[model samples]
Target chain A: MSIKNFILFLFLTAILWVVTIFGQSNNPTLMSQWIFDAYNKKEQTAKKIKGKKVIVVAGSNALFGIDSKILSSYFKLPVVNDGVNAGIYLPLILEISKRIINKGDIVLAPLEPNMYSYNHKVGVQVIDYLFARKPLFFWDLSFKEQFYILWHIEFERIWKGYNYRGGSPLTAGFYGAFNIDQNGDQINTSLKFKNQGMFKDLERHHKNPEHYGAEFSTEALGWDYLEKFVSWCNKRDVKVIFVPATLMKHPSYFNDPIEKEFYDKKIIDEVKKRGWTFIGKPHNYMYDSSFYFNTNFHLTQKGKIMRTRQLIKDLKSSLKK
Target chain B: MLFNTYQFIFIFLIPTVIIYLSIPREFKIKFLILVSTIFYSLWSVEHLLILLSSIIINYFLARKLENSILNQRFLLFAIISLNLLPLIYYKYSLFLTFSESSPILPLAISFFTFQQIAFQFDIYKKKQQVKSFEEYLFFILFFPQLVAGPIVHYKELIPQTKEKNWGEYQKDYFNMGIILFSIGLFKKVVLADNLAPIANYAFANIETISNYDAWLGIFAYTFQIYFDFSGYSDMAIGLALFFGIKLPINFNSPYKARNIIEFWRNWHITLSNFLRDHIYIPLGGNRVTLPKQAINILITMAIGGIWHGSGWTFIIWGILHGLILIISHRFNWFKIPSPIAIFLTFFSVLLLWVIFRADNLSDALSYYTILFNFQAIPINIEFNEILLLSCSIIIFFLPNSLSISQYLKAKPKLHWYHSLFVAILFFIALKTLALAPAQTFVYFNF
Candidate 1:
């Protein structure tokens, strides 16, 4: 091959790549649309709610694990579940939380334990999908940050996105955005039963128990963003409460006192140092493995009720003070 | 720093190549050494320092050995030991102490150490002359083969360095390099990585997996390692070609070998050559009695396995190969029908690879038990079966990168269709690379 032919080959490849990306960005898959719909619904609920309300902010753990309706009924205030995928990373999640929160509102944060140490840049998949729906959010980032995220986006994802032929979000059944209730919680009763695949996943974790649990570190970027979020809430007179995300009670963690104490001390000390109001002991929310739906964090319907009742008790005690 | 990554390809390689092509002939070698230093340092600065120290120490020792007369043998032994010290400390400390605590290994310590040792041995035997310090440094620190190597010889590369005409046949070499590199990248990203999940799933669930999944896992791994290492070798050779230097061919379709002896000759050919010339010949190779030859083969193969890693599994893997070689030497397996002999050889290799890939002996044993259990349970895990079958076909039927390169060289010129095919392959591989995190070459751990 001559140099001219080789350059022509490269030119052809560049054109194909650009075409794939453009096609995929214009045609959003059902999964991406579902994510966008869920976000839009939660944002609208947070905006339209009259006066001070209880804002529940977290990852999918809160979306699937919490019953905001129960919290609203007990506290006699409107509530909105502003939870999304954890792959969006904590910094952006907290930034999104700011739009929902208002002065004199109570902000309930049940962050997943791993969120404490999620210091890496946002993943390519999340950025690609979210940027198509919410270009403003991506444009808001600094040029360097935008480039870092863009550099990681793979051509495979664009090709897959372009090839996706699934129907719209409305037809996605139980796992679709339409399943989300008015209070911003996923309330599909078909997901009440435990998934069998979860057992295999849990078995793998059982073999390597140390892989579970939160990796908390003060030096992490998550901590810096979290501290800033608390300060933002303080200045606005919005109350912030930090609570543990619900988790399956694996014997490896709950049975060993030393392991249990290690995590307990880490969470309590970090929360105290930040001067955020932490309600409920970390162990209080850990339920048996049967309560889990599919992942270690997501809860079944009955499990969600149990977790909510515990949260209600903790909130009742802390709100009185 | 891996070749498959965006940062390495776009940020490092493309820029480095353009700059290298534009530089004057005299400065090209020096420029490469500087860039290669930066490349290694990007992976780790501390490890780069260790590499430099080894190069400086080995270069000086080689020069001394070439000039010295008294205690030449002792000096050679000392030089070899000094070259091996860092490798032993970083790689074998856990095995030696039988303790849990072990230090992180310095990258490429094993490859560079072995290369330097070969240089010293050749110097002592008066088979090699000491070159300029800069040439020696460039030979050692050349980034393409610095980490996982074809275990290059001093003679093969040094003479090429001295012929410094940048313009002659530059376009031809660059074009060939692009083709070889694209093929390598496709094999690694599209084939090897896709097979990894199935193998990993079965190995992670050894006790519970059925006989069907066990066989699938073993086959997946068999082809995975072959494509992974061979693809890496092709990329290394291709990158060297970009600078108008040719590297020794490291793989030549070892899966097609009809016997264990043939397998050794084809697989990891450079390492096999090193063991043959340096270790086997010195230990009274095949000129001795049958029993002594067997012992010599066993010792050489055992050292070969130990060189790969510090595990008992690696030692056992090595010894098993030695036993097979002995059997191949004694019996008339080659007299059997060609198809059956090839099948038998491939089966034996696939079995041994389990021990090589396992975390420990117990896992390997359990995996073997599962493989022969004869249970008919269904495969539960989700994997692309089509991809596995495709990889198998490619391994058995494909002409390999070297053959393809030779075929292209025979042609007067590449047609437009060839360029289009190459472009599509390259684009597909790049897209696949973007789909997941880049997996390191399996040989890099050695």
Candidate 2:
């Protein structure tokens, strides 16, 4: 172990590290399956709805629950579902929504409670890494997040190599895959959910299950971004509507009914104060447990149709004024 | 600034090592003391005052004991009580009170206090030399072993301080240090962190844990703690070596031991040594009648357990181990097969860790109830269950960091192939670290 050998070892280590960092594909599609699925046909979804009068922006709740075609036919306006996964943060959701939103376009955005907390920043980056294809999207990540992505890519390349993959099977398992339809709604509902629980069991289980809501220390950054997005839309004469997330109407669903009431009122007041439209109360969108595909807001086909009909009725009455 | 962090390795360690190696020998100790103080103060500025106060107090007390001819016994008692004060207030305040909140325990309070207490006991018994304040501070605040420790002896460290030469970083020493650090970083990031999710999920939902999940949870924690502490010890030793100093090996593959006594010698060896020297022997050790010796063993181990954390679970864990050790000691008259002995020893230790990891006494009991109950449900553990099993099996056969270092040769005189292997090891460790957030070393809680 002479000085020369020690120096040589260090030199080799540095070279390897640099090479690994630079060797990654600039296109996230070439790196991970989750990222590829997210980016694939994403631009097509956005481009297809250009100049559309109405756009629905959200995460998995909108993707899984909204029936844009039904809404379009009823309102006689082209409606686009711009929802992806719930993992996307409010900032990127606003960024993506603005891309397709034009003058006089009505933007309906409902945020899932899970994405309202401080930890949601990581969730957003995870979604961006797995899906966002643009080079700019990668740069949007914090340095720590970028480092995490680079490290994971290198880890997979070196250790997992050909078998390198990342993602949760729950999303994939429910959607049959991560594919989205041309309308930008998740379509592969051939997911095999073993009905281990009957309706009563599901109801009992979901009863009082810990949920993300006002109790979650809200991220001020998310709310601030939302306000800015709304103000921007207002300047362009593009109407922005803040809508409540869909929920299962089970007694067990609202562990703190008073908290839910307070959260909804606070959210409505905040949205209205920003010169935007506030939709129905949080509990207005509640449906039976049988209507839900699985956890929280993801709706079955019948449930979606029922929800869409209710939303159309509510919108017609509200817009008439 | 955990050892596994990029900040510690690249920002703190690399720069410190470079600067230290470039400095004159006379200024090296001063630089290290300053750097160690900075590293510690990052955790909290208030805690720094606490650490410095403890150091100053112990320093004066040790010196006084050396100089005093009368009332030495009283001073010894006073010093021991004073040392225990901060540890008890910070660590056990909530347990002592019915209150929900407690003071934040200062990092390394348990470790340094124990080290200082042992130093005081040794000096009073005329077994140790009373050194200057500079040497004493170096012994206590050496950053590598500061937060979590092998419970370093003053004798072990004070001598090593003399061997370090400033501006003369030996190539062999630096290389060995790097190798050990990489191994440690890999174990913490990959093995311990990966296993954490499974253990955490099970523990958090203890009321719903099925038998299968319970066993998996306990098994995950067993390996999690082993690799976590083992990785930390290796990193500490390796970091110490960068300055041409060697640290005593803390772990010796305790899981491979065939009995409780052997397991202790292989596990946290320094603490076992301390307990033996300061507590067991002082309490008449095995020189007394069998019943008295048994009582002494129980008392020593129970104190050892409480030293780990302030909880009934820890006490129970210690009492269980003490009882098992007594049984093992008494039963050694009959020879057992190696495989059976290993399984028994490992299984007993694994069961005991459930108590160590559980939140409370009832939780530990519930875990055992579920574990022994054969009426088990088909609990689908939502984690990499296979990896947990595989890693646990691998621990039995793996050549630990110390043995791996030995195989590389004392000088670590590398052939081209050996150098390549070590380099690959370093890359894997770096890649793994990038995969997850830095996990605090498990023993840091102690």
Candidate 3:
């Protein structure tokens, strides 16, 4: 084995990797279906909302939890559900908020626990890179976020593309199995019920100490973005109300309710101090664990009605101010 | 930058190796130290200072020990303690205080500290002497073995660098390095990293893991640690070989060993040798009475475990290995068949990995309970996980990377099929690494 031969081996391997990477990148079938649907929903929402309507900006919690038709009929305005999968971090959420938020528009954002986690933010950005593959979306991310995307997702796809030749079969099955409406909400009640046991496993997995057991922090970059978002909305004369997403009440998961309440109060106070609206107490959105879908934040049909009705009351009172 | 990353391989290594190969012999060592320093500093500039300070302090101390024959023992103890001070402060500070917000452990502090301590001890014992501070510096900070190491001794490494044609590229070593590095990269990216997610999920959600899932989790970690560390060691050796220096063989299909004694001999061979020569032999080794020898083994293994991380779990894991070794040595009560012996040895190793991989004692305890409980539930196995586990089994039977490199030397011209196989493996590894999260080598934490 000579040095020249070894060099030749390296050269040939590099060429193969580059060719495969470019070749894979060109194939649209390589994109995960859920990611494609979410990207499509993101691009179409601007055209769908005709008037200065009430816009819901959130993660998958809102996409699965909110019934925009119910909100639109009740609020007497066009409602755009701009919630995508929660994997997209708060920076992108802020970018989305800034883009669609016009003067006199009402924005309802029910924040999930993931919005405040750095790890979750990276998870969101990874999804954006893999599924959306949008240049402007990638550009909109912080330099740190962009670097993470390059290293973790795009770099990963070059190799994963070889094995996952035509994209994720699980995601493809879901694309065929369930439904995503024109408003970008996942309307898969039957599928959700069918995978009830799997949902429990997922819920338990998410509740693991490694995932969310650490105490929530106010100093997260996500929280910092929250403050900036409120300020941006204030200057633009768009009414922004920070609300709590409907959560499953699992005592084992929320072991420290007192600490949770303290954090909630602190967030509400911060939002109110910025001259923005703070609607619905955290307790108002807590339901029995059975009233949820897969995740803690995703509400069941009955749970959504309970949450939506309570939210309507809160909004009526907050708007009066 | 990690060995498995594009940044390290393409952006950093390939160009550096070419430039390093082309340079004059005199500049080669200097270039390595500079790049190694840069590599160490990538984690933190402050940590790099700490590494430099350790080298500077140890270099002068070794010189002092060399100069002072009468007070060599005293200087050795003081230097050893001084060497251990930073490691103790960084690695054990959080454990001592039970604080959540402790400082980060400097990467490879344990490894470099041990390597330097060995050098200083050799000086104190008058077995070796340093010719120059630069040679000593290169020996201590050589990037290939710098972080996690074969713990290359002063005698073996320094003389190699001083060879007349040290800077000139040897075709055989270069080619061997290429195959070894590629194999290591494949082992890491394709084999170990793939197993990580499932293993992590099972361990992280311990309550959800059933009896079969526990087996799956430990097996994943068992092979994960093997490939991860062995892979890193091979890369280190390969990288060193690129500069025409050979690092000691660190792994040799360790899982194939039929007994605990054989396993230690094959696994982390350098560390095992370091322990045997420096730690175990100093404590009376096997030359003493049987019970005393047993005690020495326990002490050595316990210390070896503590060298890994700051935790009671690691200590327990070490003690279990020591006990297993003692039992294996003393007992000939039954003549177990080779297959049975290998299976039992592997099974014991698998169980021990649970303790090693768990976050804490309680975490390991919960996993053990689930493992033995035998709950009649469905095993939550993923499609890729089964494939990975099947692939991992080949590790026990296949000729290791080092041996393959040896074979390549004799048979320099690779068959077309062999070339194609290596190319495909390398291609898959590269692609997987691109798509996956940049996983730091498991040993790097030590």
Candidate 4:
């Protein structure tokens, strides 16, 4: 390169470095609400916690008000919400391994059965959880885990997931991402069950029924990483609950088995056999199919209220236990 | 990856440049081609199959036709058809099935297909020789120009493939890689994305829009499509130049054309040339009677219009342009000075573009009704966005490429520091894409 060109390259490189470092904080259009809410809460948690027992209800759409943000308000505890939009199994594992997930946090990590293949929802959310999470983060991952990350990036949309609409906001940017850190009284609303996105959700789910697994057993959810996740949680000293939130009140195509009946039953038996608190039910919070987001397993607004009410009511006794 | 993405600009382009700059002259073309293909195919491997098939069919057939005598012309038709099959499949299928449902994979199948068709023609006419399949395929799928194109010919790109020279590595790398990329990036991320909202809002709810909004939307889209398409072309050309290959320029301030004929020649010049050479001339050119020639122009443009997309609006767009071209050809309204003629041509094309950019025929009618109906709906001007929209219009009308092309030919004497200054400005412009997600080149779907 010419001396002039040399100067130019230097200038551009400098600009990029400066921007990435400073400008990433106020990034608008962080489309997935739960992920944004998590980032909001994570930033908040980083400010609040020293060595707090943060019981996180982390999963795709499982953060915000329903999990740590709201649950903390109910219990008067400080919990870190590692909730991300479409937060599946591997990313959660990677996040936990990276120390974005803290230890001694009573994990209500929802056993999302669909995160079998590492994929979709713009791997940036995955990157944000994995790499964007503050470090003290463990550095090592198994070859399969590392390969899954790369493989996920490569085959994310094509074979991995069913998100073809390309990051259209199916829920409000304000799906209750409010955080109240003022005084002892607190309020934050992140409803995982929202129903307003009925048409969009249905269209998307119909296009790619990611719920169905490669091997069929009448389960709509792709149980790719469920077993591994359960096993992973079993080893840790974390107080865990395997709560499978379903809008399906009974047997149906939309609300799958609590884990194929056999698998979910065995896992529940194992968790109980191991003395961990495992509280869940088959189609426990089931509603009409209309209550769920038109497609996939997300809940709509009205659905969120009903589901959240039922969940908080059910989990209240468990909290006391 | 999108030209706008941080991944492409930072992750992909930066490393590619470093690798491209370090490579030996002989290895550079192969190395760059391989990397560019991988980058291009990151979205899906299926596209590669389509690309490879087109190249294979074209390459072997070109070789066969070159050596054979019996039924050579027919053989040429078969070869061209085979190459175009995927282009037809991917590009036209959705349009063809607009009433029904159809599937689409992200691929710039038309561009490669059209380029190879050009190559096939060049071979048969003894204008260009049949080369190795690798060289032919590389020309067809030269990553920069692969999707949206200047529709490069084999003659220009083939020589670069054979000749391994790296004398201008730095100059080409910085200028093409950094400078051209920055310009293209600015056009896309900053301009097109900015214009997108206004254009989208206007088109979706055209009937509800004011006359001012309609006009603004019409012109905004005109600029948006130009910048979006031409920006992609520049990016493609820039990418090719990094590997020491030059591709043709596709746009030439099309808004400055004096007549529809000149406008087509200037705008999407390759497509115009293809229609004129393949469709127009073969149909009897201007060699027939005047009215017949006018009909020929109409038919040619209709096909060309439909070539842009499969929708009725595209068909109408072609017909409108075809009518304009015929009217211009017959009337001598273009006999005025270059500026006036250019003005007339651009205004007509811009009006036609309203149809081209519309969601459908009814949407086009609604937009045009709102645009020319003179009934002003209450205009809510997002002043900053409106200003950007108008600025894009002014810049779109600015004849940058012809001047740039001329300047390049002249090889003007310039201080090294001036080049340095341009590089800095380029970086500032390209900075806009820093936060933007990777957006596919708009024409890539075609």
Candidate 5:
């Protein structure tokens, strides 16, 4: 083959690659589509609610952790849990929350610790979610971010998405869109108190309390976007209350008081400085491992009730002040 | 710094190739040596120093062996020992002492050390000579084949450095290199890496895995090691072709061989040849009594095994192969039907690979027990079944990379479809690389 022909071959391949990226971008997978459907349902619910509603926003921790119906009854107002997968980009989550939150609404953010320290780089999950829920949002991204997404998109995911037979969100069972209630809280009975062996192993492995929690950085990419979200809420006269995500109460945290104090101080100081109404201490929300469903963050059905009662108590105290 | 990485391809290879091709022909070899040094340094400057020191010491000692007459045999032994010193210190000291900690093994120490020893041996035997310091350096330090090699000899590579009319063949070589490299990259990133998870999961969960899962893991590894090593070898040869240098084909569909001897002949051919010439032949290969020859084979194979790693499993894997080779030699297995013979040989190899892949003898034994325990438990582990099937089909029915390269070489004219096929292969491999962390070639540890 001539050098010219070789270059031509390379040119042809580059064209095919670009074509593939565009082609795959339009076709989202069943999992992402299901997540998108849940988002749409939650957005509709938030829109339906009238006057002084409560909007619970975070990652999956908030979805499984909060009892929005109980909170709605307690506050004498509609409550919408707008939390989804934490793996989604933090900024994108905040942006999604921005659309649902209204004037005079209270925003309860019990975000996962890791969310505060998220690196701004685009990951596969973020690409999948954005492509499914709001592809136009992808165009709004910087060229570097888009390139990062396209580069990291696996052939397996694309192939699976292409070959995926159309299925209802119910096919996803426990974590399906169907499991999410009218207020966007995940309420599957099967996930009530199932013993997760993996969490046991995780607990054993993370005996040192030092391994837990994110290293709080005020200048983190997450914090910058979070500040923007708070500003957006503040502009609309929407009250923002920052609370810690529900955590497993490991004994090591009690043993290592210094590490515990450091962990609490970093987050509390940041939240206070940001002018968000910081509610209940993180340690107060740390329940026994039995309260956790699978991961350390997610709560079981009974655990969610306990967490909601605690949140209500914390809110009552703050609102009274 | 691995051939499979984006940084190696984009930063190191492309720039180096552009500079190399544009340079004057007389300066090309020197330029390659410099780039090769840079490549090694990128891996570790300390290791590069170790490599350079080895080259200098071996080169001077080789010259001494070539010139000195009175104590020639003593000097040759001394040179060989001196060459083995660093390899032993870095690679085998922990094994020798049964200790927990040891100095880091320099990358490709086994490969370059063996190459240097062979060159020294060749010089002593008057079969080869180092014409120039630059030529010798370029031969040993040539980047593509330096780390994981086909173990290029002084004769195969050094003479190629002197060739000047490579400009005429530049396009053909580059095209062929691309095709070969694309195939290799696909095998590595797509096949081997994808299969790695299944094998790793099963091995890591050996105590809990069923008979079916155990077999799946073993088969996954059986094909994984072949694809990983052969893929690396193909990439090396393909990369070398870009520079108009042809490294020897290290693999030739060894799975198709009907016997252990033929398997060895086809698998890692350079290493097998090196063992035969340097170790086996020097130990009175086939010229002695049958028992003595058997002992020779055992000793040679054990060394070959240990050369791969300092682990007892590697040594045992080698000794088992040596025993199998002895049995293969003593009996006329040729009388057996060819299909059955191939199956038997493949089965034996598959079993041996367990020993090779295992971290320890105990794990290997437990794995064997699991394979034969006949426990019919449901398969709990999730793996790419389609990929495993595809790998099997490719291994059994598809033409190996050498055959494909040879076929490409023989073709009179290249067509558009051929380019498209190569392009698609390259594109898929590149995207796969983008999706995951590039896995290290399995043989690099050796």
Candidate 6:
């Protein structure tokens, strides 16, 4: 067969397979089960909380970042710290940052510093936000970048859930509302985790959340590209608050002043400068070791509860003002 | 831009091909050079600088080496050092930074450093010389083997840069690319990626898993590395052919080899050749005494391990392979048939992959403890686990490593039936692209 005919056949076969696969009545692949859980987990956590005030913490592997139930109960506001550790390539933060806005909404974004600078991470999110959120805008990007964005559809699944596990039916990605209890504290460290590299990262966070801190990773003028977002929010009067959530660990002394300056002067200082309510307390290290899920960076039930109560009070006044 | 990514295959590869084929052949080399730099820059803008610097420094020095009045050895060493300096800077700099003492690492340092060192060796020997910058640039930057390589010899590639015959190019070039790309896609997307989770889970938590799981994890990693590296080599060779260049075939069914000697010949063929030619031959190869020969192989392989990564695990892996070679030479152990030797080599190599895949030496030791001390081998594999295992096994055991055109020489009759079968398989591979494209070419890091 001619090369043209060969290519044509392959293209047809691809289209046919995609059609058949998508056409099949399978509820969802093993991956989506996690997303469904994340979305539902956030909704259910919010729905269960008794108050109108809410804190929406969004990111990749929402389970990895913080415990959900403990924060919810303490705040009276539904607490959904559904942040996956997926790099910025995922549009979850960018997308959720736009959609789930409200008058009393408190948005907390805590991620690794390396994540922000990656082309793939930021690109993935930008691409998805461009196409899925607003299609006409995707064209403005260079064709290659837009083209790359088109392929990363799982930003939805990756951003919102524990998609990595592909676990059993009831707990596809939601490992039961971040099981914050005594027994859960004793995690199964027996499984020799390949994530020793990650442990090193946590060690960095543990020693000093300041140096190699995620806050330093954020841009100085992050009300950036938010000029459009800010104006849009102003017209809608969706009182927006940007809270750089504390990971409950105090940064160590080794954390240089350069990094500390970047966080204090750039991230936290900039967020406050933007007039968004900032929540900072219960430094990550002071809490008991068990209050952490994996490392010092994330909060355990005690840390989450303490922070959430402070958030409720902070948001009440911010909203009132 | 990752060789393992679908975005590279579908978005970059396809469009680049369409553009190349549409353009005249005179512009093809330049087009490819442009595409290759673009492909490289996707990793980091910083990485591209290293690539361009390698191209410029070598191109100028190579010409001077060909024409200069200076003693060739000193110039050769200078040029070789110049080539390797960037690699040391990019790849080892971080190591140096963190160790607060070691050297900096160059991006794709292993590839370019070894490549330029080979080029310098060739120049010293007067084996090949290029008069034109364009040919030199193409030799350095040819996309197929650029980032990851089957390490095309300058002699083979520079001549092809001069050829602009569109008719021959149209006939075989793209056919080779499609088959190679599809196979590579299958290796990366379907095979390497699928096995990764099991390999990752097993290797990571080696302490927690039973002895049976440890073995399972090691074997999974072994196959993952093979399919990942060999698969990349295949893609590199296939893509080289598309540009009407034939890079030396890097993998030749290494898993099927009966002994360590044969396995090295089959795995990363060019690197082996480089080590043999430069390191081994210089150190008296097999012409020396048995003990000296053993030292040569051990030293060569250990450095080979260090060449793979800065980590000790890689060095140990190299040392293990070298020791296997020496012992096999000395006692002539595993005096078995070809089939059994092949399996044993594969199994032993698979066992060693535990070290290669582990987070560090301690994890490797813990895994080894479980694997060796286990009471029984487990037969049970969960469905996803089994799927990955079976896929990894199939990727390894499969005989047809070469894409059709590599073996076929002239286009064997492009039968419609074969074409149709190829079509069905290609998109089946395509559908798997979105399943967490974490399938990086294991060799890329090396």
lDDT of 3 at A122: 73
Tens digit of per-residue lDDT, candidate 5, span A271-292: 7887766888788788876677
What lDDT does the true structure give each of the candidates? 0.82, 0.75, 0.75, 0.60, 0.83, 0.61
Q: Lowest-scoring 10 consecutive residues by lDDT in candidate 2 chain A?
A: A161-170
Candidate 6 C-alpha lDDT tens digits along A69-170: 555564555555545334333234444445445555544444333333334324433432333234444444445544455444442332333223333444
Question: What stretches of model 5 exceed 4 Å from their correct place?
Answer: A2-30, A33-41, A69-76, A119-124, A171-173, A176-182, A186-243, A248-291, A300-321, B98-100, B166-169, B330-337, B375-383
Cα misplacement distance, residue A204 of candidate 4 (Å): 14
- Interface CA RMSD of each prediction in angstroms: 2.7, 3.2, 3.9, 7.8, 2.0, 3.2
lDDT by residue (B326-360, candidate 3, tens digit) is 99999762488888888888888888998989999
Q: What does the lDDT read for residue A139 in candidate 6?
A: 44
DockQ values per model: 0.33, 0.26, 0.21, 0.08, 0.46, 0.30
Residue B229 lDDT in candidate 2: 91
lDDT string, candidate 3, A128-245, tens digits: 3443344456555567765555444454455554455454323434432135676556666433463757576546845652223254555666766777787788788887877876
Question: Across residues B186-299, which tens digit of lDDT does each residue of candidate 1 receive?
Answer: 888888888888889889999888788888899999989998889888899999999888889899989999999999999989899999988999899999999999999999
What residue pairs are clashing in model 2? A35-A130, A207-A252
Indicate the DockQ of the complex predicted as candidate 1: 0.33
Which candidate ranks first by TM-score, i.e. highest?
5
Query: Each prediction's TM-score against the native?
Result: 0.74, 0.73, 0.68, 0.64, 0.88, 0.64
For residue B282, give model 1's deviation from the true position in Å.
Answer: 2.3
Better of 3 and 4 by TM-score: 3
TM-score of chain A of each: 0.81, 0.72, 0.75, 0.54, 0.84, 0.54
Score residue B266 of candidate 3 by CA lDDT. Answer: 93
The model with the greatest lDDT is: 5
Model 5 TM-score? Answer: 0.88
Question: What lDDT would candidate 1 get against the real structure?
Answer: 0.82
In candidate 4 chain A, where is summed lDDT lowest over 10 consecutive residues? A154-163
lDDT per residue as tens, model 2, B144-175: 99999878888888886676353387766787
